[model samples]
Target chain A: MSSPARRGRPGYDQDAVLQIAVEAFNLHGYEATSMGLLAEKLGVSKSAIYHHVASKEALLELALEQALGGLEALLTEPAALEGPADSRLEHVLRGTIGVLVDKLPYVTLLLRLRGNTEMEREALRRRRDFDREVSSLVEAAQSAGSLRSDVDARIAERLLFGTINSIVEWYRPEGPLSAEELADQVIAMVFNGLHAQS
Target chain B: MSSPARRGRPGYDQDAVLQIAVEAFNLHGYEATSMGLLAEKLGVSKSAIYHHVASKEALLELALEQALGGLEALLTEPAALEGPADSRLEHVLRGTIGVLVDKLPYVTLLLRLRGNTEMEREALRRRRDFDREVSSLVEAAQSAGSLRSDVDARIAERLLFGTINSIVEWYRPEGPLSAEELADQVIAMVFNGLHAQS
Candidate 1:
């Protein structure tokens, strides 16, 4: 709507439109936001905006898919996929943390989606699949008597994954530590005790 | 908004109204949903809606207040607040997990807020306070020589809270494990090794 005041750029550019959409969704939330608001923010006509992305839901899907893809790649890395159980688990955990940090905004939005729409539900499904794979590693480690058996594999899986997923809450790359350093710190804390093991 | 339509007693009661609002907020998001939709779904006038709560923000505040109060209560419980350091730490962890299970919906929403609004920022501050208390417990446990010292207290604190906060992602109470049982399992997995302790 505010595009009326603009003089020259009459068309929507896909990448620029997506950047605006990401900010809008991040600031106001996907469901609360409107197409008119998005168009105004991007300084483009509604139809011009539509020309780049079919619908708002499509934009959500695009962002979510990329975030999930980063996660999936980390899970499937040869190091994460195959190694001595401890080594493999560490790789996966560190890689996952790295993904969350690098793709903070996108992953933050993805994590916030609670399956309200078809796209969100699908995102949830893919996420579960990824979790399922990670749980198998937890189980394998448990069966090997490497992990403590007192906790069930499922609960361990949830706690470990939960901790990794929480990074998006405060992890800002520009703030202090690099994503790599943060990942290393996370692995050390989760694997080693706060007090030096005597 | 729709209260006049249901002037008859076929109208919803207070619990019904709260549930409808929760569902709408959960689906469309808290910020996007309006009292008008809530009234429409309840088949009541906005005046009838006012009979229950002052405004949409009030409903949100009420919901979050209950969830955060549960957490604060857990921290103050004699078991969680006292005893040898490790025992107290364990008590807080188990109690917080139980609280999360009991108030899953509200806590989940609270965890996802990004502080865009004054209410959200206050909620976040309350959350940090909880984290600070938990971190103190971890520090005490380390000082008491119960926890290992290989990791820094701050990093350990993040992992501890992150693990607990992650619970909302997949902890379905309807699933096989009861909340207490899940807590037990979490403690074991976190404290024990995936590998046989060397």
Candidate 2:
């Protein structure tokens, strides 16, 4: 399938290559997928792929960056940075859900990383930093008496994001549940008890 | 390391073999772990490992059963069956936490299944059935005016258990948070929400 004509196609840019590579990585697992497999899936030669990236790990780095970059950007946005801790936390939660929905495959890949490589370890470190940032926000909300102080901030952070992260397991972009609707339901359940108010 | 003396040891049994195999499966992807690797890990010949399980798929079946059995048992427990729907749901949630904590490795394996084979397909089906059962309870609670009716019952069930299932990603038996403590925090956050009531 390594035709020069196919490799020279106008639409087969680096972004297109990355999208397909990430999908392949998510399907077969990063550790199991080889460049040959990716080349075969892309209907291109290994050289065609290498023309865009240096190695398989580069594809992973780009994918992780795509997922992490979206999340990190949320922490610094006007609403997230300027609001009351509770509101800011809410914004972050909603924003994170948006990121997960928008970059479902990339985020799914990020979540499944096992830290078997230096690149993965670095990604994990960034992820932990992101968690710590959210945990700090939770602590701020608790101190402000917006969020319940009884639950440890770290544990609260874990449960909140854990529930959010689990969406990648079952969510489909084409499914009836829109991203905004999902954010609304999650926000409602999280900020207000599910118990019917008397 | 395939010493006959090691194979003859009283401590080496099917349970022991299954335990190590599950651990290996969790560390390495299940498809990547071969029986030869399992034999090496068990310090026995392939034939000695075979004496306990017929094949690698058999080991996977046994491991999945260990995990699924724990979760399935919770559905039939009196607390899970005999209370108001919300209370019954809480009991199942707490019980699930206990099972996850007790069978962390096995459950981790079960959660990561990709359904590449019939055995995995059956396990996935059972998992869906378990999820459906929980969703029905959520629907019952909503009808009983205990759970908020606005949110979709199925979505609530997913978030509740998704948060629960995520514990395997980070919970450690030796960590400061005990299973009971973890369950309390989860139950508190899930049913009560994180917002501090004035």
Candidate 3:
């Protein structure tokens, strides 16, 4: 309700602006969203936004980095590194759902980008790298005789991520199920499926 | 490779133009890909393209209907109506993969739409209706004691579709895996999971 003229610039920092920017981009799309439109959405002057980020691409970079950094960090986590392959795979899968739900907006934006720009290409490359890393875990689990060997490791990887990534399309923040509950249900379906085992 | 001036109007009917339009929309995005660009993609003049479809929204309606119609038909199939919930669900799941691969471009464009237009809103409504119908099967399976009761039917529906829908994001028609094989692998992983049963 406060006047924009009197609004403190510090109130809208880079992270805060990036959140709004990502939401706008998600709603209006990245190509259609202009700096002027972003300013209007933020209820702040363009100069105020420019104070923190140099350009829209810079905001994109920061937003994508939040998602990429979280995923990359999962690779080095103790559960991913030191455990048996099946356990490690499960760990990473759970961690991924955690990241997807926690950083829903950033990951949603990242998934929607199609390598149109240098920044987008970089995001795609990093996403591919993440997939490869997960594939290695799937392969390892297969080799350990814990995961089914009938399916190719790469195919397994795709299905796993496919199942996980689809959440961005349908998950609502205020939906009846919590993210943890979602993760558990996904884990159950991915591990055991809907068929009631005898 | 042919000149637009020499191309006859009959060469590109509504279906052919829709195929090309969906590919263009998938590649360039629906918002950025103009009718002029569609004419360029189709090797036809703008007027020739307009002769087949009144507008881009009309083309979108046709493309989306292709996917929605296929999904809607899954409800009435003998497998969907006459069998146990597990069998019925499996039938629909396999049929869905078939439809997805068969109509990849149209479904891709449909999934990418953000409900910005009345046409897209209709598509969204139809999509929700499809989800509800599928969820009913999940609920029925749960009631039949063939599916786990611990997981909410709504959650199961999201995960099932989530796993199914992710294929559009990563599936490659020319890749080593055929659509049938992809469906099989997805089914195996979805129903049996990655864990090796002792």
Candidate 4:
């Protein structure tokens, strides 16, 4: 349903509205960010904002999907699926860093969700599922004798992704480190460690 | 100045109040948790809260100090300061995990701070300074040839601590994993990595 008012703003589509709404949600807690505040941030009337999304929760769902989708897709990728368990784990790890760098704000919002709402709870559930998938992958690597078996696979998965997820706390695209370099360092540190190999 | 009402509440001392307040801030967020809500949560009058601390920001400073103080202490510990650079780094990393586990709620509040207030900014400044100190340790280890020189020291520090800081997300003191075990796994992963050593 195209309206003259909607057409007047050429760039402010559902995507733009979602982006700004996500930024506001990330800045202010999702519960605290009202649609009125989002509309104010988007420089649009409340009704105009509604024309794009059904509600603020809808915007959150869309934003979370942008992040979760990337991660879920990584699990299904040929690189993630085809290789030896350890190398496949590496592919997923690198891919996760790419998703985080590419869709930083969305992933930040996803990570920060406290499951206050059902939508948030569902997003968190999906996140947990993703974690289980990675954990299983780690287990496979351990079984294959590529990953060290002494440490619990679940703990190893948590630490590996913990370091990756923390990138959202500080990584900036315009900053000195590229996403590729970041992935390289993470892979190196988690696989080979900081200790010099003799 | 203890009033009859204050004397009536024997258990609600300043430390107790600060602990609950930190939990509230971590749950509801610092900006959103007003004195009224905190008072309601504490089952005390607003004035009772004031008797413990002058203002909300004062409570925040106390909570942040609880977290930052622990981390800052690690930098100066005899083990942290007196050992081989890499061993010292290991000591600090293990000690940081100890602090995070011991002060989980306070550290969660500290890590979640967005610097909306001057006190938060000050905390962030202190956090950055702590990061710098650790980064310098990483550099020292690299220089000593104990740690790999390939990754930048600053990046190494962030990943090391990032993995450490992430413990607050899933770690429960009541969980099966003891703090010592968590620290051991972290040390093993960061220093020796997850790959099977030949």
Candidate 5:
């Protein structure tokens, strides 16, 4: 969980306020949503929101940080750091779906942004950086002879991440499938393919 | 090629104009772009754009038709219609990637819309219908014993498409990798899985 902003009131929390803000941005385009509108939706004074977040853009930055930060941190985790290249790659792939499911709203918003602003641009750059790191892992697995070397590592990584990110397009927390089940299916399909191997 | 509007003046094709419009809608959020802006970018009057498309919304529908229509048509193609379920599924998957590459801009816009308007909602519905059709194909392949039945058919379809749809996120027409090469890699990974088969 993110650290709360400077506490301004007895009852309200910054994380809760950010959740509402992220929802409004998700429902309404970030460019179309306003701080005033978020305050209205939160039923708090505009001053109260300002007390938590410095500005509307700040909220966007924090939301993006929340989503991308998780993935970045996953790269250094013990699971990722200590495994064979193939196992580590699997760990990151599963971790990615976990992050997507955990921070669905934030990542959805991040994916939707057009990079028209500095915050969105920074997010795009960081996203590319993350993709590059994952691509290197794919290359490593190929070198280790566990993964097929016929496909380009970069393309393989893109498809793998693409499959993972596409979850945001249709997954609903209220839906019948749990996140764990969905991730398992994804791992099986991506790592093992859909065909029944003899 | 789309039929050009009754030419008010000379020299522009409706297909060409639609391509420009799709690019604009993609670069700028669809809602944020307008007929006047499209005209200004096209170096023609708003009336000229109207000469081709009935309205802003009309162009959106046509562009959508171009993207989704390709996939809808693929369902009935000879390859999709006359093969083992596994082969038919492969044909459809490859064809889906082809359409995505061929109509990248239009599909990108369709994917990014937030369903804030009637047009977007209709597009979303059509998109869901397309997904259902593909899911049925997956089930058929599973029933045929070629594809793994352990994973839920719907989950399998989502990951399959998730990988294909993700091309819109990073594919560039001028990039070093040809669309055919990328599709080939996708097909291999998706059909055979990434792990080296014994």
Candidate 6:
């Protein structure tokens, strides 16, 4: 059985709280996890959490904001934005998947967050916006004849993200594959076909 | 606002207690959702639940067993097992996706279930078995040169299932797409390329 996650860095220590939040949210789920539980997980009182954030909702908002912001940053990266559309799309895909894997708990919590709270709703909206940016890249790639031309872009977008997002269900950082290894494998599978080479 | 997910049917005599079980299980999550709250949700006493299932774990076991049975049955069908690997794989994919969509609530709960309780672990064991069956089909498809052969069969299996598994995040049954429509779209995206032909 996997041991509980180790805490993150000490100074600028929202990282510890974020890690604990991600774990608690993932284990019990966001709706069921409470700020008090988070504080307990981090070996602190609930009031100490407030010294850093205003409310449980604020913590959630901050966590999702980081997760979404990482993805959005990938959109603006030099390699992701330039080059042939397929290569650029591939670049963005690899970068985003890498970010998701590295920040697995945070992104998992982010992806699983439904609009139960105002913070969640905002996160959901930002997620959709990220999706649209990726979709635009897919459109560009399709126009360039790199991606296949028979299926609808919207459906393709959903499948691509769906495949990428499902990584959370089975991905364990402690497993044989490192985060980078897993991301590379996903990218190779998504872009190049998975059949054995002749 | 979700129409309160009405309990019972016009003529089918749907069990109200089951509806409460499903909602509570979905909302609080099965591990955290309790008998007292379930009783409260159903507007019934806790004894009413015991009258139906032996315990909370029993309720979970029944639900997952039913859902997994539906999925396993599809995998063994002649169409899913025979034909060109792509066609058979597509048949399996479409059937599985359809089942997942038709049984969203049950399957969603099934997918999110961690091996917390004995019943949950059994459900997980069955899920792994189901995954293995599908992976065999993927392996067969690769051997037949129907699927790309560049990626490892195991990882490829993960991708195929991952893509299918992601439906939980976005699909809305009450939305415009019928289950069959969604299934077709999902199948096409995974198997047939998505770029529009010039």
Task: Report how closely model 6 matches the true complex, as a DockQ value.
Answer: 0.40
lDDT tens readout by residue for model 2, B78-197: 988997999999988898899999999999998889898998999999988988989999999999999999899999999988899999988999988999999999988888899998
**Across residues A1-198, which tens digit of lDDT does each residue of candidate 5 receive?**
222453233466789888989999998778789988887777667898898999999999999999999989999999898878989999988888888888999989877777888778989999889989899989998999999999999889888888888899889988898888887888888888889776
TM-scores of chain A across the candidates, in order, are 0.90, 0.95, 0.94, 0.94, 0.92, 0.87
> Which residue segments of model 1 deviate by more than 4 Å?
A1-17, A31-61, A116-120, A192-196, B1-28, B31-58, B113-121, B193-195
For A1-198, candidate 4 gives per-residue lDDT tens digits of 234555446468899888888888887778789998876676667998989999888999999999999999999999889979999999999999999999999999998888878888999999999999999999999999999998899999999889999999878999989999999999999998899998
Query: What is the full ranking by TM-score, best candidate first?
Result: 2, 3, 4, 5, 6, 1
- Which segments of model 6 are wrong by more than 4 Å? A1-12, A28-55, A143-145, A178-181, A192-198, B1-24, B31-59, B83-86, B178-181, B192-198
- Candidate 3 chain B — worst ten consecutive residues by lDDT sum? B1-10
Clashes of 4: 0
lDDT of 6 by residue, B1-198 (tens): 113343222221225556557767887777678888876666555776687878887777767766798898997799986788767877887888888887787888888776877767878898888888778877888888877765566776788888888887678889887877777666655554343223
lDDT tens digits, residue span A41-151, model 6: 776667777777787777788788778989999988999877988788877778878878878888988877779877678889999998998888888888888887555
**Per-model C-alpha lDDT, please?**
0.77, 0.90, 0.86, 0.89, 0.85, 0.75
lDDT of 1 at A194: 43
Proportion of native contacts kept per candidate: 0.54, 0.74, 0.72, 0.72, 0.84, 0.49
Pairs with backbone N, CA or C atoms under 3 Å apart (clashes), candidate 3: none
Model 2 TM-score is 0.93
Against the true structure, candidate 6 has what lDDT?
A: 0.75
Alpha-carbon error at B74 in model 1, in Å? 2.7
Say what the interface RMSD of candidate 3 is.
1.1
The digit string of per-residue lDDT tens for model 3 on A1-198 reads: 235764554577678889889998888779889998888777777888899899999999999998999999998999999979988888899999999999999999988887889878988899999999889988998889898888889878888888898898778868887888888889888877667888
Return the DockQ of model 4: 0.79
Which runs of model 5 end up more than 4 angstroms from their true locations?
Answer: A1-10, B1-9, B116-120
Error of 2 at A47 (Å): 2.8
Can you write out model 1's per-residue Cα lDDT over A1-198, one digit (the tens) per residue? 344566237655777787678778988879778888887787766888888999999888888877899989887679986777767877888878887887788888887777877768989999889888878887887677666666676676777778787787667788877887777666765564343456
Per-residue accuracy of model 1 over B1-198 as CA lDDT, tens digit each: 345645445556666777678767876778779888887777767888899889898888887886899999988788986688888888888888888898888887787676878987998899889888888888888788887655566767787778877878778889988998887766654554334466
TM-score of 6: 0.80
Q: How would you encode candidate 2's per-residue C-alpha lDDT over A36-123 as one tens digit per residue?
A: 9988878877998898999999999999999999999999999989979999999999999999999999999999898989989999
TM-score of 3: 0.92
Note the clash tally of each candidate: 19, 0, 0, 0, 0, 11
Candidate 4 interface RMS: 0.6
